[model samples]
Target: MKKIVSSLLIVSAFLLTACGSGNTNSSSASSATNSSTEKTSASSDANSGASEQEYTDPSQLKDSYDVIIVGAGGAGMAAAIQAKEAGANPVIFEKMPIAGGNTLKSSGGMNASETKFQKEQGIEDSNDTFFEDTLKGGQETNDRDLLRYFVDHSADAIDWLDNMGITLNNISYSGGASVKRIHRPADGSAVGGYLVDGLIRNVHEREIPLFVNADVTKINETDDKISGVTVSINGEEKEINAKAVVVTTGGFGSNEEMITKYRPDLKGYVSTTSEGSTGDGIKMIEALGGQTVAMDQIQVHPTVVQKDGMLISETVRGEGAILVNQQGKRFFNELETRDKVSAAETELPEHYAYLIFDDALAKRAKQVDFYKEQGVVEEGATIEELAKKIDVPEETLKATLDTWNKAVADKKDEEFGRETAMDYDLTEGPFYAIQIAPGIHHTMGGVKINTETQVINKEDKTIPGLYAAGEVTGGLHGNNRIGGNAVADIIIFGRQAGNQSAGFVKQ
Candidate 1:
């Protein structure tokens, strides 16, 4: 177990690609980095679910373009595609050998309200309700303007992806959501790899220039405006000129130095973010006089398999799994906000819990099936047998399941007030349990950005020629990020940044 943990850390630090706003499965890391090996038509095997994405070598790129995008994750790629569609020449540079960052490992789904997908399934929803739910989920600390814009434009972003031949028609619930607003692939696979593959394919189809292993060292400014960036390719520095620069380099969740600098309490905790998530864009923008917000608001996910530092997606709980302690007793509401759930877990005797489900979930959720295949899941023929396997009190486990199954059937969680995700009962045979603990998952704070996706300076003025989106920019998620909102943020703000940057260049 120790060897596996050590190897995962080492792989994430150097070779493996991390999540943009998702969680890591070591196999997901390999799938992300596969792009480094297959540059032209970078087609990954079944493990990654990535189609061919053509990328250029550093030597093949032009010295200048209309828009220069740093980071080739979902946000960067989306920005590039939008800029190209807006009649601007955009070039993307990814520091890692691979293109996808943490986005490659996103197992959950994108959140969007008032989408055709929802209406088709008779899942009634509204943008206003989404805003209210998200605001409350973040403890009313999110920027109202940004939050409003996100909810309003999320459905359009879903449509945009749909137009690009990437369909997220499957809808489900996520923690902190009031309804089934989380959209995933029709087959209910992980959304991270699927979204990345679709975006990469679109970028390739557009013939947009994308380079891997190209690190942007500096966001250059000329005459108090964005000029371009200084990048290192093949260990040599090169200056690339551009009319506008979009920094979508993700957040700093994986940067222990940065995390310790801000929240020292999380210094030793394992992070589920991609190693590339080191706040490079935030630091670069700050050096250019940009301001930051909520720099200390890092969020830890509630359910992580600590042995390999793999994140068990919140979708699991939202899909009807329960968290039980060492004594096999259910604790807090399984559908509560991540921060609350994480705090609840810490209050337990062992500071860890097992996510218990049944064959219904194992067959329903693609992630659980993958976990089972990876041998991270323990199984037994029945609930009592599962308790024995996990070394919990068999009687206590049986009683807990009996009570919880009754609650599901009665549609009332009288114990913990779990009002959502009670659509299923754990009555199926061959129950499963995955031991979990909290791990650093997301950085809720970053360089400040306005609704236009322009970087804000210390004076609260827009930084000319500089824009950002995704986890690199703060003010959207506030104190905590809701599940599925990260994907919404990247797409909605990514498109805005792309359009706004192109417009800036046009000026």
Candidate 2:
């Protein structure tokens, strides 16, 4: 039944393309020209093995591949590798000059269930607990089935990454989890970049074809089934066919238009996602009659640098940092989930908070030296001098410090539950104030997919030959997403979509 519906849609789309070609010839020609130019620029890297010499633009690419993966981020790369491993010819298409969407900037920590790391730490957890925590965090708007699938498959995805030579340190930081399941790369660089590097290496080893700077503008469908894609490379338009097309172009965290339309609160705020995260996959999927879930749900990172759009990893707070307001009073518990922290800070005067830490914390935290070298911190021999340097009221800061010091000496945080109460006082001098504000980080809503990760249409019908994974498909994170869940969601569903799609070739 699925195959029949897909075939009918394919035939219908071919007819429409043929009939519309004459009337829209000029538009089609322009699109083709733009696409060609972009492709030429992308393939111009001679050292990367791409020929510097120009090649003739093919009128139409032979419309058929076993699998076509869109957006070369974590999900797309995972799907491409999975399809290739399953004996399928997988082609990956990316619009950006470089692959890896928002994932490139991601912390790369993933939440998984019952992992060796968790066991090693003696932290007891299960998929059931993960599901419950996720649904609670999302306020029950998340699809239970998809959430279950995510929890169940998360550990496998981590193992898969390890098998692919992606090194993840077994350190567990705090987030929306009952135990320590979050893993990061050993090099401590961007997690998404590391994942992409591994996937790209695997793709190259497998000799899979990848077309960068190829923007898929349209998904050609007939009678509700997908046929091919109309891609714009450079300025040239080209028609490419595929047996299965996976839309993993990520969410619209960076698109102000979409952000304003759906999540108005995040309109003026900076986003941590990559420049290519413009909801291309969401718009394309919606055009194909797919239904989107939780379109208004957006994640806000609590500790983004106000002057520059750099992510201040939550690990700082998880490791015992504090957030203070202008009055130098501790605002909220830093260990709370990002949404809660952002919400608490939003209600305060000026929607801005300062991340305060002493010399001990400064030396122990990751990226502390980087922050100091970047001049985001103020070093003073006295707390009064530090306050003056950061432009905070010295008296207010001193008073706040006295209260906090007493609390630390007593080994109990009266205002907020700070776990590891360090004995270092501001009297030792050298205080730091990194200005932080809530920034749009991730979109928790996108194309609705079922447990099988198949794209569901507005009519509640499955779109044959159409599948989506990663941030492109919603329902994993309902209203708010936990810290490590984003990575888990992408890789788990990415591989699922790939494994399912590899077996989807029409006889």
Top-scoring candidate (TM-score):
1
Worst 10 residues of 2 by lDDT: 12-21
Clashing pairs in 1: 18-101, 18-102, 18-274, 19-102, 20-102, 20-103
> Model 2: how far is 358 from its true place, Å?
3.8
Candidate 1 local lDDT, 209-300, one digit each (tens): 77766778899988877899998764667899998999999988777778889999987787778767878888899999999999999998
State, as a TM-score between 0 and 1, how close model 2 is to the true structure.
Answer: 0.83
Per residue, candidate 2 scores C-alpha lDDT tens digits across 1-507 of 222222111100000000010111121223323333443222110011211212212332346677788888889988888888877887777776556566655653677887766776687878898888788778788888888888888778878988889866555555565555677766443365456667776766666666655678888876656777888765557778877888888888767778889966666786666667778889888888899988888888898776655667665665446788877778777767779989988898888888877776665454565566556666766778877877778888878778777776787778877544243444444666788888887888899988777899999988888889999888789888878888888889888888878878534
lDDT of 2 at 274: 62
TM-scores of all candidate predictions against the true structure? 0.92, 0.83
Q: For model 2, what is the C-alpha lDDT against the true structure?
A: 0.70
Off by over 4 Å in 1: 1-53
- Give the distance in Å from residue 164's predicted Cα in candidate 2 to where it truly belongs: 0.7
lDDT of 1 at 334: 88
